[model samples]
Target: MLLSCGQPLPLLRHTDVPPRVVENFILTGYRFPNYSLRECLLSAFRPTNETGNFWTHFLPFFIFLYYFVEVFGWEGAPHGDAQFFYPLWNYFIGVFCLLMASSMAHLLNSMSLVVREVCFFVDYGTISSYTVGSSLAYYYYIHPRAGTVETGGRNDSHMDLKPEHAGSLTSSYAILDFSVFFETFYIPSACVVAIICVLSCCNTRQRWRRHRYLIRTFVFLLPFLVSSTPIFYRLLTRSPYLSASSSFAASTSMSSFFYRHCLWLLMSAVFNISKFPERLAPGRFDIWGHSHQWFHCCTFLSILDELHMIKTEVRAILLSPTLLLPPAVLSRLPGPTVASTYGVMFLLQTTIISIIVWFSWHANSIHGPERDQLAKDHPKKPLKCH
Candidate 1:
């Protein structure tokens, strides 16, 4: 049967037309009969083409969520236990938001230049939020705050504070400290994001004038003012109370070092720039073992390592009371000393070793057909026509 437009109602198929053309037809307010609807729906829900994009972006969120919940529910006390949990939770949430934003941007970006521009802004916003959130989390947990005090067999109003909180009121002050810290990193990052967005969106002539102005104003100025002042003041003050050295401090420092400096920065840079393997053989590594995929793997590994460190530290703190002491040490140690010292070390080592083994095995076993498919699908010059 033919529709009102003289088009066959039962013969339409996406195979007969490019996906772009179909998208355009729909965007331009065209309608089709049963065959067209079937084709459109099939194209929209196609498993093969979009699965990688969906899973790659969303999987990180789920994985992080699981870890966050598990860690939060863990019982027992460690150094900075409450502090560690809160910041890490914020960091994970920030990362999850970033992944979601990035996924959306990548998925819809190729639809049109306008769509690309919008998505780019969204992606930048997500990244900024992530940075801010992570820094804030760190600041909150590291800084000192008010604790409860008991007097005369009852809770009293007299202020009780840790060394870190000396001359301050509570952990709430950390909010301001974090705000400044966030601004420091975020301003420059925001500028970079803005420049990228403008250059991506604007034509050559328009970019020179209009985009530059926007970049200098919104991206440069705002971030500069917000991030710089507070960071400068904090640095100048040399406040020992800002961040204390606890077991949690050691664990978080190690984790952050791996994630922020080694994993996230290094991996993201390599993937974005497509250096090394990608440069040597562009299309060859596209499908399964591309630079991007490797980057993802590295990121996951980094996060896992961080989580392990946290877990180890927590376990160590909780098990401190049960560990045995060496003969020489036990003779000099107080009753609680032996268990706490040995327990901490044992838990730390166990967590670190277990995480290392799991990741190493998983990494080794990843070679398969998926890698081959990626190479085949993503040739070096995938965008040569454009």
Candidate 2:
């Protein structure tokens, strides 16, 4: 049973392992594909069924990590406008952490039953981490709280300056009805939501296993919908003068960014739901260009698009950074801006990593139970390959 890593990999039939581990024909592959931790990392360098999945997000993770280091670890950071750079650093690190979490989930694919559960935990956790990253950028750079005269010391929505054609260098700013919401608006309690989501996805309950894909997708997107509710709502009630306003271009950019983000994100969901390209031509997609690959690709593109949007928003605010809050109010805006974001990202990532590690150490604990569950779920024997 203990095969040497140096030996040539064996071709595993669909029946070689539990049906749940490789549920569909596309998930089926040869033996020796499941290697030890050290070989698994090395296997990424060679071609395998999981190559595309592992590298798709893995490469993007490094790209984002480089940006994270450039923003915070470098000497120049913490030197200039600390206020601007600090929040930006927090945002970058949040993104980096989420990307890495996603990559690891993909990297550990087609692993043993116990290992797969740990990856499931990591994958589910990243859904929230990515949402937190997005919400961080939205809160800190996209739409911080600002008080207007009519609101009476209340600042929660994003305000756009309407540029009236007057013989003046400056135009008076008014709150746009299509106001963006604060980061803490619906995001403050996302941690609880995240915990729930992870549990729903990772639990070995029979009810959850019935409609697994739908359940996982809904749970994954729940956090995204919860955090992005403000943006979606603002778009619904957008204004006519929004284009001609000073923040028009930036607003347009942010809207475009959000659309792109949602588009790719939904594309990922579609690929997941439909199991496309592969479903059309079954065995052809076993190695690459499958739904999972497209999902990761779309996710990477969406994240990349947001990076540009973040830069545009930050630059726009730098022009009139103090317009929203006075000196007194500025001192108390840490929760939504940077501190809370940092805290949430760290908490989610650490807890998820801990769960993954624990599951791994006690892997044998779940093997028997999960295999038994799979046997009950699929009472018929696995079909023999022709």
Please report the candidate that would top TM-score against the real structure: 2
Model 1 Cα lDDT, one tens digit per residue, 1-386: 22345433232233443232232111221112112223333422333222344456667777766766675455554333333344455556557767787666545543333333445455555554454444333332322111211111211111234445443523333334443334245334433443333333232212344343234224423432342333333333332222432332433343343334344544544554443464566444433344444555555555555445445444433333222111122122222222232342234334434433443344324422333443455332312221
Q: Kindly report which residue pairs in candidate 2 clash with one another.
A: 12-31
lDDT measured at residue 64 in model 2 versus the true structure, 0 to 100: 64
Each prediction's whole-model lDDT (CA): 0.39, 0.58
Can you write out model 2's per-residue Cα lDDT over 308-377, one digit (the tens) per residue?
6666555445434343222234323443434465666777778766655665556547475764565466
Candidate 1, residue 136: how far the Cα is off, in Å: 0.9
- Models 1 onward score TM values of 0.43, 0.73
TM for candidate 1 is: 0.43
Model 1: lDDT equals: 0.39
